[model samples]
Target: MKIVITGGAGFIGSNLARALTEQPRVTQIRVLDNLSTGHKPNIAGLDVDFFEGDIQNAVLLDQVLRDADAVVHLAALPSVPRSLRDPLASHHANTTGTLQVLDAARRAGDLYVIAASSSSVYGANPNLPKHEDLTPAPMSPYAATKLATEAYLSAYHHSFGLPVLSFRLFNVYGPGQRADHAYAAVIPKWVSATLAGQPVTVHGDGTQTRDFTYVGTVCRVFTNALLRRIIEPRPVNLAFGTRKSLLDLIPEIEVATGRPAHREHRVPRVGDVSHSQADSTRLLALFPEVTPVPINEGIAATVDWFRASAVIAASS
Candidate 1:
């Protein structure tokens, strides 16, 4: 099977590419990324045909999707703060880009398209253990874009007879997730800071919780979905029902890195959800083989990767 991954050089995308390479049934892996948020080195040493380009380009999308058995669309301008600052850019990249990719997939006959939507789409709903049936009340532009992404995939599946699956991903973290950016996720950013003897910034008094899913588990699910050719019109919550607060995570980081975290509490950023947890009933019913990695274990592995990365950077 030939698989094409959009934004396949980013954190999750690169990891997914690595996972697909090990599968015997996957014959070819093609990665399409513009490197705006993704690094080419992320997919380095992998057996993949890498195409550096934006998903907004129809010509480029057509070229990449041609003769592909499946397309895992993971490209987007991620981060709520970034989207709060510039809504149009987020819409263009996340919403419009998804439409373009869907059109390209329609052109490519009998292709299975799987895309990533975010748990943030459940913003302002104030529901614990968010389920697929809940009405999505997006607080920020980022969440809106993700909601649109899910909607587009459903539309394409029903209207155009396209086989598509949209997974509403929670906070996914692990190796290959970068810490250098201002919009970096909490795990990588905090782990990197604590390792560097710096204070880890805690937004919103560290009480806000998130259902953090390990990237390996996510990649495994994606691989399984591709191999099985799973198609669900409704967006499925991709995270297991495990909630962790920022306060709960700090000690785990301290334990893993063998260093105390100097936390600097600050005012919570706008458009940030207070808490998020997933109702994984649908996900489990579909992929019962998935076993979640414990938060402590995942944190330990993440710290090891950051430490190794620091060593590599210093040596270079």
Candidate 2:
């Protein structure tokens, strides 16, 4: 099978590319990334056909997507804070980019397209263990764009008969997830800060919770869905029902890195969800073989990667 992954040099996408390379059935892996956020080095040493370009370019998308058995759409302008600052950029990269990919896929013929949506879509819909049936109340422009992302996939599947799956990803963190960015995810940022003996920034007294999914588990599910040809028009929550608050996460990080975290509390950013947890019934029914990596274990792995990266950086 030949696979094309958009934004394939980014955290989850690069990890997914690595996973696809290990599969015996997968013959080719092609990666398309604009490098606005994704680093080219994330996909270094991997066997993939690399195309550095934006997904918004229809002509470029067509070239990369041609003759691909499947296309995994992972490209997006992520982060609620970033979107709050510039909503139109988020719309163009996420919503319009998704439309471009779907159109390119339709023209590509018999291709299975899978996309990454966010759990942020359940914004302002105060509910525990968010299910697929809940009406999306997107508080942030980022969430709205993600809602549109999955909605567009569903539309393509219904209207054009294109086989597609949209997974509502929770807090996905693991190795290759960079902490150098201003809008870095909590896990990577905290891990990096703790490793460097710096105060980890905690927004809103560190009480906000998230259903964090390991990048490996996410990659496995995406690989399985691609190989199995899973086609669900409705968005599937990709996270298991595990809730961990920011305070709950500190001790785990301390245990992993053998250093106590010095937390600097700050006001909560706008458009940030107070809490998020997924009701994984549909995800389990679809991908039962997926076993979630325990948070402690995942954190330990992340620490190990950071240590290795630090050593590499020092040597260089």
Candidate 3:
């Protein structure tokens, strides 16, 4: 099978690329990324065709989508804080870029699309175990764009008969992810800080909970979504089915790193939700083989990678 992974150099995309390389049925894996937020080192030493260009580029999308059996769309400016800071950039990448990919896929003749959505689309609905039936009340520009893109995918599936699936991934974390970015996810940031004996910053009392799904698990879902033939585009929650608060996360990090987290509390940023949890019943029904790694185990693995990378950097 010929597959194209958009944003294939980013954290989730890189991990997905690595996982897909192990599949015997996958004959060719092509990665399309602009390296704006993606790292070239992530896909280094991997056997795949790499294209460095913007997803918004029509020529680039056309070139990459050609002859592709499925396209795993993971490209986007994926930070709520960053989106709040600059909505236009987020809209251009998340919404416009998604439209371009869908258009390309529509023209590519029966090309399957497994696109990445986000849990942030739920916003602050005060609902537990967020399900697909709930109305999306997006609080941030990022979430809004993701919601809009999902609508687009639905429309394409209904009108154009495109086989598309959008997985609303929760907080995904694993190796090849750095905490140095201004908009880094909580796990990496806390892990890095705890390892370095620095105070881990907690926004809004550290009570913000998330369904932090392991990247490996998410990759498996991507594989399933790609291989399956869907009649229409549908949004499914891809998560570990477990939720943890930031406060609950600190001690786990401390245990893994053998160091206490010097937590520094600050006012919560705008567009941030207080809590989020996903009910991935639909996802599990589709792929019963997916077994999400426990949060502690996942954290330990992530810390190991961060420590190893730090050691390598220090040695250099």
Candidate 4:
């Protein structure tokens, strides 16, 4: 099987690339990234082809899609805070970029395109255990773009017979996540600050909750989705099927590093949701073996990686 992963140097993509290398049926794995936000070090020394280009480039997208049996579309400007900074940049990467990849897949052949959606698509809906049947009410341009992509996916599937599956990933955390960026995910930012012996910043009083799933578990879902010939009646949620508030997370980090989190509370950023918990019933139907590591266990492993590799921790 030939696979092409966009943003292959990013946190999820790099790890997916390395894991795919071990699969016996995989003939070649190509990474198409512009390196705007993705790191080169993530894919260094890996046995994979790396194509550094924008996904919006029609020729390059077509070239890569031609021979690919499947595409893992992971490239995007994926942050609510960052999207608020420049909505136009976010739209191009998240929406237009995704459309381009879908188009390329259509032109090349009938290939399975597994798009990387986000939990933010659920928006500010107060309902717990978000299910796919709920109408999406996106709060920000970032969330809006993801929702739009999901809608577009169904159109492609119905009209062109493209086998597209959307995985709305919750707060995915493990290694290689960027810290110190204008839009850092809460886990990496907290980890970076606590590891540096600095006070961790808590926006909105540390009450926000998320279903933080490990990256490895998410990767396994992608591989499982590829192997299955039929996917079902709804888009799937890839999460731990549970929730933990930021208040709940702080203690876990404290235990991981053996230091208390000195937290500083501030007003919550605009477009940040109060909570997100996904129902992974659909995810399990596709891959029953995909059990998530406990949130604390995932956090402990992430902290150990940051602590053991000074360069990785410092670079981010």
- Compared to the true structure, candidate 2 yields what TM-score? 0.99
Q: How many residue pairs clash in each candidate?
A: 0, 0, 0, 0
lDDT for 235 in candidate 1 is 99
Q: Tell me the deviation in Å of residue 90 in model 4.
A: 1.0
Candidate 3, after superposition: displacement of residue 127 in Å?
Answer: 1.0
Q: Which candidate tops lDDT?
A: 1
Candidate 4 residue runs with Cα over 4 Å from true position? 229-233, 311-316
- Give me the runs in candidate 3 sitting further than 4 Å from their true place: 230-232
lDDT string for model 2 (1-316, tens) is 9999999999999999999999999999999999999999999999999999999999998899889999999999999999999999999999999999999999999589999999999999998889999989999999999999999999998999999999999999999988998899999999999988999999888888999999999999999998899999999999998999999999999999999999899998999999999999999999999999999999999999999999998999
Q: What's each prediction's TM-score?
A: 0.99, 0.99, 0.98, 0.96
lDDT of 4 by residue, 1-316 (tens): 8999999999999989988888888889999999988989899999999898999999999887777899888999988888888999999999999999889999889778888888898997888898887888788999999987887788789888888888899999987776858778888889989988999888888878889999888888787776664444257899966799999899999999898789999989899889999987778777788898888888888888777677765688
* Alpha-carbon shift of residue 133 in model 3 (angstroms): 0.5
Tens-digit lDDT track of model 1 for 1-316: 9999999999999999999999999999999999999999999899999999999999999999899999999999999999999999999999999999999998989589999999999999998989999999999999999999999999999998999999999999999999998899999999999999999999878999999999999999999999999999999999998999999999999999999999999999999999999999999999999999998999999999999988998999
Candidate 4 clashing pairs, residues 3+ apart or interchain:
none
**Positional deviation of 269 in candidate 2, in angstroms?**
0.8
Worst 10 residues of 1 by lDDT: 102-111
